[model samples]
Target: MTVTPRTALTIAGSDSGGGAGVQADLRTFFANGVHGLVALTAVTVQNSLGVQGFSEIPVDVVTAQIKAVAEDMGVDAAKTGMLATAEIIQSVAKTLDEVHIGRTTDTPFVVDPVAASMTGHALLREEALEAIRTELFPRATLITPNLDEVRLLTGVSVTDAASQRTAAEALLEFGSQWVLVKGGHLCDTADCVDLLTDGSAIIELSGPRIDTENTHGGGDTMASAITSSLAKGADVPTAVAEAKRFIERCVMEAYPLGAGVGPVSPFWRLANPR
Candidate 1:
């Protein structure tokens, strides 16, 4: 008899550039030894430089994909990214709720509050931001937000470690079981510091910042890594730490592959011949 690999699901938008969104999530899942499934919320015309246009998939189509995957292949863990509209967010939240009701033990949801691309193109509309805060955040197991997304969600500016902690705490009140406030956009030091808090304690993860322009989908990739780790039975804190370390290594060895901010090689761990 053969043992089948665990499966993970990504409910996100599509990146025509094949660098972020569902593409990045699936890459991370495969790299971490999970079969990847997808429920596309939108289609984006994007390149390494920027996103040019986007069209959201209808609610029915989104719902159909979720039901199809949840009913058959079954997911051990899941992550969401760039649900372009209020309707999409609400739809996904409901679908995840149904999945949770069915398989309470194996369902972990990682929510990446992706608002804009690295090139400054808006991915989620400003109005949809409120929908995520109101409808989706409460259902997520963990929410991963970068500096800009933290500001957008909590109306707080994170300029230092102290501010990051405060932001993480405030974000916890939004309804996620835990919050990871990414400090990559801060210019104060040569290290990237991220704060993971679950209301009581804060876990600070720091690593040497890779001085490279190839960070287009770092946020998406990190969140997916955490989801993959959790699907493989790691605790939340351990998963976050491991994912952070993996991302740091990827960044350190990042190669420029596009004219704009490029993608971190998600399969870097596999390429090591040692």
Candidate 2:
């Protein structure tokens, strides 16, 4: 007898460089033994150097794409990233609400707050942040935000562990059921620490720091990996743990492609299977 494969959906932007955005998400899902699906919100012109520009698809088209997937394939879990505009955010949120996706316990919604590229190029419209907070965040099963994004979203700076907790709490106030604070950008530490909290007990995930600038799609990969794990029946904590382990290996296996920053190896199993 054959078993059905789990399905994971990534509603995100497109990356011409193929290092980040929906491309990375799909790659991550597939690498984790998931059947990947996507609903594109925008198309980006970017590479290892930086993002040149991006153009958002119409709200109607984005909504239609999401509905097509939800009504047909019926995703086991979903991941959200790079919603470029207020209109797009609303469209994605409304579509998810209409389809009854990501609102239940079994099907998780993993959201990555992708506000900008690593080099400080803007990926999300400033106005879209408010839209996400009000409309999209409350429904998320988990929200993953790097330190920069956490500061931007909550206006809370991370000076230490307490400050990180404050920022995570502020995000929880925005209605995210759980918040994962990524500390890869914190240069003050010898090890990178990620904080996961659901307004209760906190789980601190730490890994030995790997010095590499090729972490272009690392955030997207983590969130997509969590979604894949959730679709495969892992709990939120287990899903996050699995994702963190995958990312550490990916960071270790990072390889440069161009003159600028490189991207993590989503398919680390191919090069270094464990």
Kindly provide the TM-score of model 2 when superposed on the true structure, using C-alpha atoms: 0.97
Give lDDT for model 1. Answer: 0.86
Which run of 10 residues does model 2 get worst, by summed lDDT? 98-107
Best candidate (score: TM-score): 2
Go through the candidates in order and give each one's C-alpha lDDT: 0.86, 0.88
lDDT of 1 at 127: 92
lDDT of 1 by residue, 235-262 (tens): 8899999999889977776667767777
Q: Residue 36 in candidate 1 has what lDDT?
A: 91
Clashes of each: 0, 1
